[model samples]
Target chain A: MMVACAVLPAAARSAAGPTNPFLRLPMVTIATHRLVLRPFRRSDAKEFTRLAGDWSVASMTSDIPHPLSEGQARGWLKPGRREVRFAIELEGRLIGGAGYYQRRSGTAELGFWLGREWWGRGYATEATRAVVHYGIEVKRLPGFTSSHFVDNNASAGVLRKLGFEPTGRGRIICTARGYEVEAVTYWLPARYAVQAQPVMARAASAGRWRAWLSRLAGRPA
Target chain B: MIDAIRTDRLVLRPVHPDDAEAIRAQIADWDVMRWLSQPPWPYTLQDAVDFIGSCSPDDLTTTAFAITHAGAVIGVIDMRINPALLPLRGPGPHLGFWLGRAHWGNGYTTEAARGLLASAFAAGVGDTVYSGAFADNAASLRVQEKLGFVRNTETLVFARPRGREFPHVNTKLVKSAFRTA
Candidate 1:
């Protein structure tokens, strides 16, 4: 399925300014020698809905309810108080989501889920690392935390490789699975003191323009 | 005698009986108590004492520590573990914390959270950490997010009191996505 593939216009990618209160640092578009991380677009709604709405994705996540709908996917893309929410772009396609919510506390939580077709390709790990870097270097956050179902070894393995140490667990009601599952917690201390290059400046600039146009057009960014 | 956990900028120790007045004053403020789940209204010194006395190392399930900045206790950070649960039965620990209103916007909670998280990780306590806040509690939620806690889910009916309702934004932090900067 081609899904939504509308490219945001160039004019819409450069109209951002300092007065743009919503404009953050930049959407860190990380390229880890393999994948590209970019911001979400309105066109991505169809595919995002299809992938995020899938029972498989829902089954693994505690928050994503089953019978996923386009409205929910669109709602997920809407800007909230959090600063970083980006689409996991691989080979120029929106495959998943990876970003930080609760941007100010010097620690932002990272969450991401790939479509079933995109599974086993290491996209989740790549996207996760990119976001972690953004949180530490670009955002200058001090720490970060994440968790997964105990049975979701893949998620756990990704966190471990990123240097997160497990510290606790809790019980969560997985609505899609229709049962409670055991979740393991992990944490990573903020050690990015050296300040890396501004990775997301371009994406931020482009995203701001798009957001402005979306507002102008009365469409969501 | 209160055991103190000292960091470069702050000291985390135990809450004492005499500290009750300060605790009461802190929690009684609407800015602080508004986001808290317990202690409805009319917060008193007795409430502070009860809170302190309830915290014991032997409890194993919950560990509450008083946060002190410049020699004065300013807030509290705690870890809640479910002994009856699995995964946690092995190597994971859940965490939660709060700072007094006077201490807001100063990175105190973040400092205290990192210190406690380090202690928990260093001890080989668990493999992951989880925490949450009310959806509207932006500051508390921001602290957890800054620490890399992802949104897990939202609970509709977390707790209800006399003619009042409380919902929670349940968030979790897995080990795989953690990075130290």
Candidate 2:
């Protein structure tokens, strides 16, 4: 459906901006069956430092350093204009972190790190899927890119479940490891959710519904 | 800003945790799930709870309502900032809705849209509203037609439930053209 802006006379319209409307929005707390992926809050700083500080967890991520410091953890949580970061929580307890950082090329890069103790339970996959879906369904991002050190087999399995396809191999420094390591890059188009079909099912039809809502005992939605 | 709407046959209200079971019952149906762009297939109670939890009075980006008849939720409707429109223009409300298959053909959908659209326009957020349905969802398209929504664009929409794209027709309604009744 046409938007209100189009109804205005040319002289009244704002300076033409980029036409594509799909861009990062204010970070929103995304929820899935097993997780609550939310913007990091100050109260979480201590737990974040502890989990990300673990040697097993820090070693897997590219930027997080060993002995993750309160100062460094605070730096990661700083509100950013170009990226959306979420602190992954399970049952009100902090576990890992997942979110995307946008590139000037107009695509977001998805990244995540889970506590060593929380590994093997599929929380990484579950948390990352929420981020990906939020990128596609809510943010309208065109695609996402991610990489894992080739040696991190557990991480590779998680990416596979999210349908991230191999793009190439490259070297990225693992700060926790104190050196560069071989990594495999992967890409997943936002379109993957709406892949090739005879017709675009349910895409772009946000107006396919009508109805007003009444308060449900002061509930949301 | 709109918190509640009352149509002759329906009370469009905020979704409640109590509505969780009913929302799951209808949305899990392939008949409804197939038409929605979001909401994964094999719908779970957790998904329903998540959706309800996501709704908030303060969130200007999305406003959702449960379409209730006789105090029972039979459907859901929402208007939210169309992310695609946020750049070129501003936050334009995108309207969408779905009902249990059993509730179809009762004119309830149209009634709900009228109440919500009128309230939205009255809020002075925007003068026009955008909406559309899957090409094959003629019933949904017809509902838009009744509200004075004219076809504006056509494109493929990715749906999570089907895990594949399907053709969709997008439409829009201006305040002046809406059918208030």
Candidate 3:
């Protein structure tokens, strides 16, 4: 499942070339106090398919399709894709995904989805804060813009807790529902992002070392 | 392909590269821009070129024309799909336009937009069209009113260039209503 933040910077965006620094940044792992938000690996496909295939999860997102299969999940997680996607891990298990997508120059949108079992656990909030924080602190983005289907108050609550203010109303086509849905738009400037608590400052580490260090550092198994 | 549609005093046709200069010149005026949602303040030539470059004559998503008078490019008019943002019964395109500051009061905007709407319907874009203007943009509202656009709702909408929200009037025009009214 996906939620998006799209903000095009006037000076940096051009028809021919994008000067936005975030557009050039590679997707990397970000960590929060309760979650490990890392870019998806091919092996995570099975778990991704399992969680994202649920209709309730798929309907809330803009792009996730219903009845998603492992093969489809793998294709979407392919390396070298423009948008950055993360596998949200808890207790070393892939429970959900979150990431930032640069739809055009100067602006990037944030999206995330957790397995139905993980609902109401605040995992989405943690993972989204990690990604949004990374984009602002590391990628130098000014802020993020997000939208939620009006009926999806749970998602709205996550944004509200993250300091995103409702700006207006818009619509986006939900691929799962096969129709456009009314959505409320929200914006969070980088300054507000600083106020989001528990933004754990974890460095990017790769491979077995990351898992070993995560375990050694007294985090969840 | 976007073909030229003629009115009594203006020719509406697909915007061209050469129109970039005129677009930049006309839209740079604060008086011309304060109401527009996208184009940044201090509009530039590259912005005009980019806009013109993105227009596809064969693409149904947008139909943009350089509003010309006696062969001189003065402004632009376009009808673009709302992409299902409103509560309309079926698909409907949004009407957007801007006339060069020098050309504002001659009824040219209404004339050009009317011709473009006709062309859009002929091309099967949509039967109904939706439009919006900043509540303070009385001239824009008057233009819509002149074309029989029925005021539907007023809502707060973000104008990106201005970086703030403003009350905006959402209006709709149906072919049948236009034909009778």
lDDT of all predictions, in order shown? 0.61, 0.70, 0.70
What is the Cα-based lDDT of residue B139 in candidate 1?
86
lDDT of 1 at A109: 61
RMSD of each: 19.1, 14.5, 18.8
DockQ of 1: 0.01
TM-score sort, best first: 2, 3, 1
Query: Candidate 1, overall lDDT?
Result: 0.61
Q: CA lDDT of B58 in candidate 1?
A: 47
DockQ for every model comes to: 0.01, 0.04, 0.01
For B52-83, candidate 2 gives per-residue lDDT tens digits of 98887554336579999998889999887754
* C-alpha TM-score for every candidate: 0.42, 0.51, 0.48
Position B155, candidate 3: lDDT: 39
Cα shift from native, residue B157, model 1 (Å): 4.4
lDDT digits (tens) for residues B1-181 of candidate 3: 7569898899988887888998998889888887887676567799988989878776545658889998899899888764324332125678889999999899999998888777667777766888878767889989898888977655334454554333467778888776422
| Model 1 stretches astray by more than 4 angstroms | A1-221, B1-3, B58-61, B82-92, B157-163, B179-181
